[model samples]
Target: MGQIQLQNIRVYAHHGCLKEETSIGSDYRVDLKVDAQLAKAAKSDDLADTVDYVHLNHIVKEEMATPSKLLEHVGQRIIQRIFKELSIVERVEVRVAKINPPIGGDVEAVAVVLSSSLPNFGNQ
Candidate 1:
């Protein structure tokens, strides 16, 4: 198995429990890590033999565009979509971070991490 990681994907999104937070929006960051069989692609030099990172990135961007109440929800959607769309992805880990969150204190960001494996994510 091999891993592919996409880090620090920046986006502006409306995702928060507060009405003001959702309407005003904030800068967000998304990270994705996936495990797959890459030996075939490495040897054959064919994109079809491995996970397409471009597709994975698209998943993140699309998911981020949709407003959710919590980061966990956003992360979950990213993990689910990757598994559903990529047959070769054996595992996935996603992190959704809201920069300078409105927590009434000096905080850099708040993030939620969610992960899943093929067996654990069977049919959903």
Candidate 2:
């Protein structure tokens, strides 16, 4: 399987545990790694045979635009959306980073990362 890496994808999103964060919004950086068999696309050189990462990025951005209570939920939503929207994907790894978090203590970023595979692995 070939891998598609979409790293350090920045988005302005409203997602956090605190109410102020939700209303004010913050900078969110996402790194998505998608694993899939690209043999057909590689051989045929057809765009349809592979996942269109540009479209995938737009999907993730759309989900991030809406405010959510938890980053975990947002991350899961992103994962689910990828699986639901794209058929060529076999596995996905998502990392959501809240840049300049609202926590009391000083910090550069706080992030949540999640990885998941298709339910029917044997089919892959």
Predicted candidate 1 versus true structure: per-residue lDDT over 1-124, tens digit per residue: 8999999999999999999988999999998899998999999999999998899989999999999998998898888889889999999989899999998999999989888999988655
Query: How well is each residue in 2-118 modelled by candidate 2, as lDDT tens digits?
Result: 999899999999997788898899999999999989999999999999989997799789989989989998888888888888888999989999998988888999999988898
Global lDDT of model 2? 0.89
Question: Candidate 2 clash total?
Answer: 0
Q: What lDDT does the true structure give each of the candidates?
A: 0.92, 0.89
Decoy 1 TM-score against native: 0.96
Candidate 2 residue runs with Cα over 4 Å from true position: 120-124
